[model samples]
Target: MKKTCVHLMLLVVVFCLTTIVQNRAFSELDEGLGKSLKQDSVDVWEDFLNTLDRRGLSDPHWELESEDKEKLINYFKAKIAASVSEGLTSLPERLPSYVHRFPEGMLQTLKSHAENVLKVNPHNGAAAKFLAVEAFHKVNTQISSEKYPLLEKAMVLAPNDIEICFFAYAACTRLGDQTREEALVALERMLERLRGGDHKVSYLWTVRLYTSEVAATPVQIYLKINKKHPIIDRWEVVLTEILAVFENELLQTPDSGVFNIIAYIYEAVGDIAAAQAVFKNLKPFYEKRLAENPKDRTALTSLANIHNKLGNTDLAHEYSVKVNPTLAWEGQVLPEFSPVVDLDGKPVSLADYRGELVLLDFWATWCGPCIVEMPNVKAVYEKYRDQGFEIIGISLDTDEAALRKFIKENQLPWRQVFDGKRWEGPLAQQYGVRSIPAQFLIDREGRVISVKARGKRLNALVEAEIGDTID
Candidate 1:
């Protein structure tokens, strides 16, 4: 089984148990239905019961009562959870491959279960939330008309539910005026409840996850399409509330992982100063922890990460070296290389690009995200090529013909290195590239500067490095 599938199943199991156990909502089993459910081919109900065993509901015939509306809500929750587990087990690893690749059978099964829940209790917000999420994931761009109303309804019915509110908020950003307004109102309602410490809502971790994903959407869209989303102003309202909430949380529980979350949010919104301040504030806490325990792994790791982001490279390396002796630090000289040739059988050397700002882009023809990122990278390259800015394309493509065709068709003007070894290519190994679309921006002095210089940030970094007249 795929690792993603396993992890997702574990998370779903944990989340479902947490919900049911915390709510303490169990019902007597209906004998005929329970027997039929157990005899069902997939045994989802049996798995859910097995999962329920740890909560001391281990009776063989025990199952949720489907007739009771309140119990039915929890019952459907477990049903949806079981369906997801089944789907993950049976489906491909790439869930984000979206509609074209998503199994039609699984989608219909989930849709049917969600619809059944609504039939049992039309007011069941969880069912509405599930359908909204299903619709949100099934499309490529915007939420369709068929899905939008469901999403809007979920927002109205489950305003306190993080997933529902988040999907509704995201969908609204892609929609028209009235719907956007409705989503904003719903988000504000949730924010107010969160501020008031409403127990109906899930706590910090889940809210933080939703906030992080929402914060990242605009950045990801900008990176892919090279356009600031049309609803950015609306996003600002949401971000401001997020910042306020996290800031308040930090004041309540200082020196927590919430610090990292706040810093990430600031960075996502391009508030560099605010982000660095959060990191700087967090530094002393980890530093003091490291001082107390010289070999504290958590402290060492956190300090290293924080210092790296703070541009204190020497400090970052000092902490990182103590943790992992062989780890390379940012701002060190780019690693020396074995002889390699570009796609045209021409020799390629990093040393040749010395005294020029260069971006080493690790990408491949088969990677969808890598292709999505091309337009932004290409635009940055064209804008800065005359001012000592260059990009060395490190193509992790096993098929040289496909790579060549893509390059030629895209009219990419940069030199490209390819060994047709895919992820095992020497250039990728030298940089410890584990993921496609990995990028490193190196300075004129041949020192590694930024590893995540992509999207609009790519243009900004290149322009800052080489687009200005040097004294």
Candidate 2:
């Protein structure tokens, strides 16, 4: 499947992309008094079901009967009725207007339509998922006893659906009971399907699908709830299954997809020793690929990334030049810019710090995550200031007063540059920075060691760059 289709599928799973109630259409449907609403609701039904069909919600491996199609459309009528009665869409902007209580009338309509679909086609995963999402959302984000059955039914109906499996696992994580086992089972099943060759999707695709904000929130909730559980061990098993597939695939084909997924899985699991070993073993495969087809962009980029991760900075840069030298990575020289005045009107330039390890921190005073990370940044600075470590804060804040006030109150000693353009500031645009709290760790030679040094990782990268030990 294409990446765009995968994204749309994610939106559909989270109930955010479609199902907007056209006020006129819904009003007309409402006036019909239930049974007569059917004709007026077909447009709404088509809007919902067509979106699902386009987004790959149904199993492409299975064919739908004519009767099943009718039942599926009816199933969406429940969803439409619920959406209309609640006076809300699942769009992010409409979330503030959410209604907590499921109206008795709305519930009755949903139940009737759901029963209509399930009685005909009990394996209707989409209907089961709709019921599950509604049940979870209606109770003010609370876990209800009623939700478990719907989630289980959804899993049973669509064991191979990654979205449904995610929902099932996510819902299961909320409870403090044996549901943890079920949650793992759901995730394991998802991994099994991805690796079984039944679906043409890759493990990396599954990883990307879950990385989105909407999809990740539930997993975050799971982590928070299961703090005492052996989170790493259980998840490591699921990830290992994916690696097994990659390992087997590599024996036959030196595919970049398989190699990249293997690299990501190792890094995600935090097995640095294993990651080093795997990347080392996989290096020759990419080298041979490039040797045969020197213009293979995928191999060139992958080889550069592998070398960078393995701390082979020189080799990383050599391969990176073959791909795109402008792309920042370990051993790539920091992009040069003319000397610019700092917040205190002192002239500053990266060239001035060519022999000093520096951190180019792009952040704003108004950014919440940046604010939260200030103390940690301060700690790193205080520990390394005398040992040749420096931080250049590129403030992406348009508010000069707030920026200065935060700097003064916090007693931050670093030089800051502000252009009053927020994200449009020159330094930010120069580096293609799209988000804040982004830090680029520069070595003493003015080479970027890492572009994502933040939080606890900041301390590690700074230490590695400056070659210093902090007590």
Q: Highest TM-score, which number?
A: 1
**Candidate 2 lDDT, tens digit per residue, 19-92?**
45434444544554343334444443333334444534344353444443444334346443343222222211
TM-score, model 1 to reference: 0.49
**Global lDDT for candidate 1?**
0.65
Candidate 2 ranges beyond 4 A from true positions: 1-42, 45-131, 134-150, 153-163, 170-180, 188-259, 262-301, 307-313, 319-340, 346-372, 379-392, 396-414, 419-453, 459-471
lDDT by residue for model 1 over 1-471, one digit each (tens)? 699999999999977875674344222222423533223423433343343446343355644433332323334445443332211211112222222222355456556877896786676565666677677663434445556778777656654544455555665545544354555654665565466564324245235334443433333332333225566666566657666666766676684577886787788777999999999999899889988999898999999999999999999888876775424535788866679988789999889999999988989889999999999999888877888899999998888888889999999999998888886877776676767788889998888878778887887777777656322
Candidate 1: segments with Cα more than 4 A from true spot: 1-184, 191-201, 204-255, 262-338, 343-345, 349-369, 375-391, 395-414, 418-453, 457-471
Q: After superposition, how far is residue 198 of candidate 1 from its true place, in Å?
A: 8.5
Candidate 2: count the clashes: 0
lDDT of each: 0.65, 0.65
